[model samples]
Target chain A: MRLINQRLSPGAGAVLKTLPFVALVLAYLLGSALRLAENPNDKLLPALTTLADAIDRMAFTADPRSGAYLFWTDTLASLGRLAAGLGLATLIALLVGMAVGMLPVLRALLAPFIGFVSMVPPLALLPVLFIVMGLGETSKITLIVIGVAPIMVRDLAQKVLDLPREQIVKAETLSASTWLIGLRVVLPQVLPRLLTALRLQLGPAFLFLIAAEAISADSGLGYRIFLVRRYLSMDVIFPYVAWITLLAALADYGLDRLRRKLFPWSELEGAR
Target chain B: MTALSIENVWKEYGDQIVLENLTLEIAPRSFVALVGPSGCGKTTLLRMLLGQEQPTRGRILLDGTPLPPEPGPDRGVVYQRYSVFPHLTVLGNVMLGPELQANRLTGRSFGAARRALADQAREMIAAVGLAGAEAKYPAQLSGGMQQRLALAQALMMKPRVLLLDEPFGALDPGIRTEIHHLMKRLWNELPMTVVMVTHDLREAFTLGTRIVALDRTRSRPEELLRYGATVTKDIAIWPPRVAGRATLYDTEHPQAQDDLTAFASPAGTTRQTPSLI
Candidate 1:
């Protein structure tokens, strides 16, 4: 059969799905083995045992001075900042986007401003945020909000605008007040789109969070990764990087599942 | 019963004109089907009646009073597409009108009130033949089922005027017939005025008691913008089909059924009745 026409069995498909991952792991193992063979102590590529030992020390054991589990603490701190920033951004985007999209006066006033702001690189505002908000949790959370909120707002506003005008007219004829139209009509439809926009913005949100943490944080996943870099501890750095990647993947998966469960209509064929 | 009057209404968009010097008096409980060629401002006239667009030159009155500057519960509308809220389930869509009207701020009711509303909504849904699909979203429905749901949603509000802007224009011939039956039944049962815009003349004859046509007198490119559409023909169906009157169509008269079957068939296959014109 032609390659395009070939269909994989379920078991074959599963194996094929894992092939690239298996290849990657094997290649990493081979590199580590080769590096360790040349030097008894190589910090570039730690062996599996060294990586496992680093994980145990960071996760199972508490920090001797602070008496806190470093891995859990870092994860909690990072997750808290992410939740706060994204939550605030979600609320603002829902409000501002709906207003700009639905009301002509608001659109005339704010659309241009939002367009301009969305163009400005959010990372460039990091120092400004720090200088204004101070070097606390607020600054880190604000960085994520500033980084993701404008794009989210723009996306949500466009989504609202793209909605068929018929629906709005129908709602009006149903005797919905402007406020009720926003709450019942526009809000329900935009929520799933908002979740989708958030999923797309997660990578950038994390980037800003980490960048802000790396430059000026006492504790976080980014803080730990940057902190251990000076010691040339590839073992810790490697595990932490892997852990971050796993967390991001898990978050993305969870968000997608949530969107499907909450708004199954969105997943329907031809639904926008 | 509510009567609507459009007094020399003209809708102009800057230099371009859409509707010009339109004067119409629609009786209470009348089914007025406005038909015309595309871009003849038929839908534009419907929008003006619904208060979505204001007439630049004249006033529209409902029940001897000026229409509210905006669309209100007094007027309900269904469009060719997007008539139902996609996010809402069938039951929710039907109940939305009463719920929003009953509670001003939250648009919700609680406990016994909510249950009562749900029961009413379920009854309405069932009336439109969507009894078992209460939990399904609009997107889950076929185009025909969705139009049924939209009909139920609009009728639940019990508006004084029901405006249909090609509500079944996108449906298949078979489904359109089904919806036409439901629409006739609803008009017979309800005490509301209905103004429907359609491109299909057969559909207008099938459902409307009065048929009105809009067209431009001058079609020249230079004159297109200079002349807006006006009512070219005003027709009242013979043997006067009035609301609350059991029409032959609703009674399943043998001849009416034959006409419908002919209407459903491919064009030019069978001779249509003069009444169907």
Candidate 2:
């Protein structure tokens, strides 16, 4: 069979997808066994049992000092910040992006500034955000927003600009005012694109959130990970990192589902 | 009913003039087709009529009043594509104009008002032969059906003038013929003037009660910037199809009578036996 023409059955495709993941686990186990066999006291490559024990200690058991499960607490704290930052970013991106896109005066005023801000490395502004907003939850949330909002705004504005000019002209002929045009013609179409932009910004938002948490947070996944690094708790650190990755993946899947549910017409557009 | 009068309109984009010294008097219920080759500014003139682009010079009067500077519900337009909003379903798209007109703030009607709007929209949809596809989005519709929905959407506004920029140019031949009949029926039924722009001469002859051809007198690149396209031929259809009342013979230009002799049927041919169709 030709390579491009070859097709996999559903059962075969499922197994093919699992093979690499299973192989990675097997490779890790083999390496851990070899390292442990050489040095019984080694903390670098803990056995699977040690990792499972750490998961139980962090997740099931309560911390002696705080009397709360650190893993659950950290997850909740991080998730709360992520939601707030993302929600704020979405609102700002919609309003400012629509203004910059639909109005020539506003586009001239803000489009260049947004482009310049988006070009700046968001991580470089972490210190400034922390200093201005302080070391509270506000600073951490602001870091995520500052990291993602400009890019999201730029993306949504471009989406608006790329819309067919005929649609706007048609809307105007329908007696639509400027505000009505934005609300009816532009907003509904730009919404799906906004969700897409939000999906793409998730990874960067997480990076900024973790960076902020690692720097000065009292309780978060990143804080917990950085706090235990001195003691070299690789077992707990590995599970925390995996947990974060799982959360991000789940959020991405949920957003994709929401977009499909809300804007089914966009699927036919083959929009990115 | 509304009549449109264009007096010596000129459209120039910087150094390049698109249209020059164009003048036309569109009757109250006439279907005037602006036919031209590409870049000859038939679409530009249509855009000017639709209030999308203002004439760089000269004037356009609707019902003897100066046209509003921007597009309004007083005029409706259908393009070759993107005439309907994809985000809205067939019913929603049809009702949008009325909804926005009734409620400026929300652009929506509610309760009994919305129900009434839906009924009118459904009636318009049925008029365009799209009765069963109310819930379907524009993306779910075929090109012909989308154009039908666009016609319904534009008609829902009941504008004084309907501007079509090759509204059926994107449809297949079979669909185009079907929609041409629908277009003719709508023009006959509604009280509005139509100005359509098409590159297809057969389409112009098939649907237009009067055909106006535009072309440049000069062809050189340097002359192209200095000179612009103007009306080269203006021919009125024989056995004239007028709606509501008979049109007087004075509307026909005697100078263009000899121009359409090559395309028209023989002198003794019946009214139904025109060669252009």
Candidate 3:
């Protein structure tokens, strides 16, 4: 009990730091609940009520087989697209980021172009992308890439630029070649920052994915929500949204654990 | 033959000249210390020798050959700051040089190269008194330990010439003394040509077998001042005996040796025996 008290005392500042996030979440939940209570028969009200019912059903249900399989399948399909898009984005972004970061001329020439393109919203490009690539997986995947790659490139490049120059000079003194210095000295320092950036971008990546899907796709979570909204089938939309939130939370948590494991020095700092 | 020679080396930053017409020669297996006031171009000279910078005029030659544009395995340098890569473990930093140069492993086969390099790195680390720090990163170690790791990394390359630019300047006096002793012992065992720059007179006296002072003056030849003393057992002995030469003591006068010994002692030492040899 004494140890717990001491730990809590030190965490008082951290608790205060998180107070706003907690307050925002509480306000959101209370507002939605009050709105549902005031208009139980309204279109939006049934959707909100259906969301509550779905949460209750999923939380209390003993058997997963009782629920509709469409929700689960659509969830899996959405997750698969996300995985594919993010994986491709990560690979391409890393290559481009490393190249630009290491070479000054390349960075200067390409950075302006990338910055300008990143500002153009992916949704705004959807009509054009659909005209060119059609409403297929290619267009959707291309949208994901356009949305995620620029941020990845900028973040990773900045991290590379911020690497301690002394270390690079030391490597050069040791006669380390360009490739070896990049792989051994540069990459490890940037990995933690890259992982952190990737985790932070997860929420936006999912947002863009849903937006892309709603614009054109007839499958995945976004399409499911759109299809069900026509008949005011709030129960279906609620389950899908809830599942997406759960997936996002789970992914963020997994990345956090990975970062801690990979960087034990940061973990030590956290302990302090 | 001179193992290393610098002739009329000039370094300028815009309008300011750091080194003007500086010339020096270091013989094989000799320890030469360069000592002067701060910003006197001692580091500039070291950097030029290491091929990190090119002199505005003149050239640095290793074994009568002009130095290459880039630093090679022929010269190893240790900086005052702990320059070991913070992201790599101690072993990784030490092994990087050899792994990059000799092994040339590609792709997944780097694992085997890394292991072999790690073994040699462990030996070098132990030699430098960092026996169990192989797995630890640079940030986890103290400043002295990090400097030692840096030295180990340099030594593992086994370069013919070792260049240290005030390697112990940033360390505390006690740790500085320890590292100085360690460096002296290493030099004695390895017997490589070494050129070190330092501002600490005591450090120069302790580590240098021959010390040279640099005088940089505009429109004048750089003066090289050699201290003709040997410091041993914390006592400065007078008039470094010319190699393979004999010195006759003037026992009848005694004042000759007394005068010489008085000149060798550090400024604060009190002289009680004015006439005694």
Q: Residue B174 in candidate 2 has what lDDT?
A: 68
Model 2 Cα shift for residue B238 (angstroms): 1.2
Clashes of 1: 0
Q: Please, what are the lDDT tens digits per residue for candidate 1 over residues A1-272?
A: 88999988999999999999999999999999999999979999999999999999999999999999999999899989999999999899999999999999999999999999888898898899999999999999998998899999999999999999888888887778889889999998999999888888888888988899899988899999999999999999989888888988888889999999998888887578
Candidate 1 recovers a fraction of native contacts equal to 0.73
Measured against the true chain A, the candidates' chain A TM-scores are 0.96, 0.96, 0.78
Candidate 2, residue A243: how far the Cα is off, in Å = 0.3
Report the lDDT of model 2 for residue A69.
Answer: 96
Query: Weakest 10 consecutive residues, lDDT, candidate 2 chain B?
Result: B249-258
How do the residues B1-277 of candidate 2 rate in per-residue lDDT, one tens digit apiece?
A: 8999999999999988999999899999999999988989988998899888999999999999999888999899999988998888999999999999999999999999999999999999998899899999898898889998999999999988999999988877767767876887788789999999997888888778999999998988779898999999999998787865445431322221223443344445436654785
How well does candidate 3 reproduce the true complex, by DockQ? 0.31
lDDT (Cα, tens digit) per residue for candidate 3, span A116-209: 8778888788789889998888888877888888889888887777765556667777777777667766777677777787788788888878
lDDT of 3: 0.72
Q: Candidate 1 overall Cα lDDT vs. reference?
A: 0.89
- Per-candidate Cα lDDT values, in order, are 0.89, 0.89, 0.72
Candidate 3 wrongly placed segments (more than 4 Å): A1-38, A43-49, A55-68, A108-120, A226-242, A265-272, B14-16, B107-119, B214-277
lDDT of 1 at B189: 90
Please give, for residues A1-272, the per-residue lDDT of candidate 2 as tens digits: 88999999999999999999899889988989999999987888789999999999999999999899999999999999999999999999999999999999999999999999888887888888888989999988888888899999998999999989898999999999999999999999999999989999899988988999999988999999999999999899989988999999998999999999999888875232
| C-alpha lDDT (0 to 100) for residue A208 of candidate 1 | 88
- Candidate 1 stretches with Cα past 4 Å from truth are A1-8, B247-277
